[model samples]
Target: MLADVQKALDAFGEREINRVFFVGCGGSSSIMYASKYVMDRESTSLASDLYSSNEFIHRNPRQLGPESLVILCSHYGKTPETVEAASFAREKGALTVSLTFDPDAPLAKASEYVIIYEDGKQGGTFANEAPAIMLELVLGLLSSKEGNTKLDELLPSLENLRGIIDGEKAKSLAAAKAFAEAYQDDKVIYTMGSGANYGIAYWFSICLLMEMQWIHSHALHAGEYFHGPFEILDEQVPVIQLVGLDETRPLEERSLEFTQRYGKRIIVIDAKEFDLEGVAPSLRGYLAPLVMQAVLRQYAEELATARNHPLTTRRYMWKVAY
Candidate 1:
């Protein structure tokens, strides 16, 4: 799949690509944030932006033309808005690439370059997931445009992601169970992180906690903790702080310091705790969020079990038209 991603980028040519747009919705939209963050930090000449599929179409940036690359994603590739976004991008003369599990999906048909990721329902490893694929695309762009060598070092680690993620998930189970036992009755859960991990916090808050578990939640940026959100903190509030190994570590640490003073029920999922045996030190920052995500999955699983509400339970998601 990485080879396919590279081939797509190579065919597009670095000289022809000046801007990038990532478009999706819900969890798909959340997962692309890390890539956009990486691109923003690493690429000097390239411009990148992320948007929900509908918004991408609605805003219709004037820069959406021949020199632009639009990457869209959908788990099953049938998301109506995402498919429409793909077609919209194509109509605007931008090179359109898409990541999806279904090759025959509407999104795939709508894209010019389609990368089919492994379906999680079919035992796909984290290496083959959307985030990993998108990260590789971002690395590919960096390598082609800015001469980044990190991708070469990161590829081997990405290959070993399955074992690393499994080990971390195993280590996280005890903590997840403990969290489930302690915070089961809490009505609203708060998630916080900075840099790349913010997307994981966002996904956990919306997709797992609120959407799946029927709990109210909000994702707070660690950098914005002191602005207004910290006023809501108290010993009774349940806050999950995701600390990643990125440049934004200090921001999370700062928030953690303040959070520890007032919030008694804080669950810290720090990436530093994971050994990440084979992963290179240079790539840890880029890969930490995926590790954090795997750990959060265990928390969601245990919490759903503790609440006796299966994660698959949904009231108005697929049942009613929004």
Candidate 2:
């Protein structure tokens, strides 16, 4: 899948492409947030933007044109708004690419370049695959433009990511079990993280807890917590902090310290605690969210089991027309 995406990217030529837009919905949109972060920090020549499907179609950016590349992601590829957004981009003469689990999905039909993955193969999480592919795509494009060998050197390490994630399954399962057991009775949960892991935090809060398990949850950035969210901290409220081994670790640490002092039920899922064997040290910061996604899948499953709620149970997601 990575090679295929790289090939599609190569066909565009570095100079021909002016901007890259990562557009999606829900968890898909959250992963694009991380992709935009990577492009902003690493890419020198290419510009990157992120937009939700509905917003992209209604409030389209003026920069979108024939020279622009729009990357649309949807696991099922059937999301009405995202499909409409892809059509809108195509109408504007922009190149459209889609990443989805189903190659024959509506999203794939709307795209010129499609990258498909087996549904259950990516550690039971769609969040893990898209970012890995998108990150490599951005890095590869930037490396070609800047002659940066570091990105080329780091690209191959992503192939070993699955093995690294599998090696930590036992540890992730244990942590999930403990977290589920402890937070089973909590009425509402608070999740926090910084940097790339912020997207994972948002995914857990919106996708897993609220949407799947029907539990009330809120996701907040560690840096933003002190501004307003910190006022909600108390001894009874449970907090889940995802700490990554990145430059933003200090921000999460500050939030952890303050949460620990006030909240009695603070659960920390720190990537520093895991042994991400075979992954390069220099790339750990970028891969931290992928690692957390693997761990959080286990946590989500365990939480569903502990609460006697199946993850498949939904009230309005697929049952009714929205």
Candidate 3:
């Protein structure tokens, strides 16, 4: 399952490159952000660029050159918008790398490099998203010589998470089941995350919509909870918090309190359940989100199934046509 991804990492590690531009849409776009965040926290090996496929095709005007390598993220090479970006990247003379399940996928055919994730065949939304997360970790590890930086340090734990979540009867099912029931009636899903977990917020919403659910969900930066989003909270509304162990615990705690102030409950999913006051301040933030992401992913799926809905109503993320 991981064979192509492993090869992609080895290939990426050997590159003597300059600028790195990461381009993907929807779940695939998270890969670009994850890569940027991981590298920014540790080193300056390469200057990185992150762009959504639509933006890259319609709005972004940056130059793509031989000196720059574009990490093109798409689970299905058939996604027209991303495939267009893939074509554009090629025409611009930039080296392209892709992470996908099929080695011969149109997206893979469009890149100079390709990585495949064989976890399971059809996750729909989950399919492309998981590979992006997995490859980002692997690429982060291969980037350094010490191989002991924060990114490398967390790779094993992240890998373990992918394994656990891959199973149908994983331990996270129970928690996921419970959480889903709590918000079954919610009109919107507010996924909150801090520090590295920012990507998680997006990851969760993507899964809920793709895992055969029709929920309208959006991501919130953890500390940014103070924004007007707090304006629409009440007993009928719930704000699910992705509380991880990280340097930003104090900030997360403050947000937790703020959510409760709106008369809403704060559900913190971490390595283990604990009283909010007793959780660690400086925590192991890396792997905590993976476990919960898996748990909540299932909950999101169950909620949609109970309501008789398919992952998302739209054929794709066509948010607008005007």
Candidate 4:
């Protein structure tokens, strides 16, 4: 999967892409989400721009013209929603691309182009790690190409990031820190963010809810926090803010200060500059989330296990009304 992602990345070199839409169900959508986070300002993405196939007939009807390229992602080719989306796009004359672990699934046959992700493993539940890493690789390639970064030069740092993420000891340390902050006496977790980090906030809620601690969680925009979310803040319900070096730094800083002003506590993840309190500065953009994934994964798994839950499950998700 990693090498394939690298190949897709290597193949992307600002190849005159005007518009691309990414469609998927559940975590498969992360490809588009991560892509949008790393997307160049010069280009536009419809990646996170998802729509339910059943609803399309009434709301937000897709006008798929011949010139559009639609990227379809599904870990399992059987996801009815995604497959229907692909079929709809294809019938409307859009190009389709699919990335899936199962090469023989319906999605593989449905897509015009397919990238197989068989990591020498048999059937198992799809975790958050592999899909995120795989999508990141391809989008990183596409992004680097668009940003005009020498691919060879960026490869080393990207490799370094991969190494740190893959290393158990480093992941352990980061996870320990995140657990202390995430599961500290508070049962309520408030996720707030701005800019690209907003997606991280969204992803955090997903992991925390679905995989990790099954605690009550809510996510909101950092600026909007002052309007209403701030009222709910207290020591027992501390705010977990995503602060990265994106365009939202100044506002995040103000948000950090605002949290402290009300005696509302916070644990900053991926923010810049610490002159103020709760400003956890991480690397810029996608790199920040990559760097923080270790801790996030750790806290999520540990909390889930501590509550006697398995890290992966299939019982509930298979209720597909096919």
Clashing pairs in 4: 243-270, 243-271, 271-280, 271-281
lDDT of 4 by residue, 133-164 (tens): 44454445446535534333334444454444
Q: Rate the local accuracy (lDDT) of all candidates.
A: 0.89, 0.82, 0.60, 0.56
lDDT of model 3, residue 44: 49
TM-score of each: 0.97, 0.93, 0.77, 0.73
Across 146-175, the per-residue lDDT of candidate 1 in tens digits comes to 788777887788888888888898888999
Total backbone collisions for each predicted model: 0, 0, 3, 4
**For this target, which candidate reaches the highest lDDT against the unseen true structure?**
1
Flag regions of model 3 displaced more than 4 Å.
Answer: 1-3, 6-14, 61-63, 121-159, 162-172, 206-212, 272-284, 310-322
Sliding window of 10 residues with minimal summed lDDT for model 1: 119-128
Measured by TM-score, how close is model 4 to the native structure?
0.73
After superposition, candidate 1 runs with Cα above 4 Å error? 1-3, 120-125
Per-residue error at 138 for model 4, in Å?
7.0
lDDT of 2 by residue, 1-322 (tens): 3556766667566446778988999988877766777777677778888888999998889999998889888989999899999999988888888888787899888987788754446355332377777776666666666664556545566767776677676767887898899888877998999887888999999999999888899899999999999999889989999899888899999999999999898998888877866667877877878878878888999999999999999889888989
Q: What pairs collide in candidate 2?
A: none
Candidate 3 lDDT, 83-170, residue by residue in tens: 7787787787776777665677888777777766544445332323454355454345445433544444344444344344555236
Give the deviation of candidate 3 from the true structure as CA RMSD: 5.2
Model 4: residues >4 Å from true position, as ranges?
1-17, 44-63, 118-147, 150-154, 166-187, 210-212, 263-265, 271-283, 313-315, 319-322
Clashing pairs in 1: none
Better of 1 and 2 by lDDT: 1
Question: Residue 227 of candidate 1: its Cα lDDT?
Answer: 93
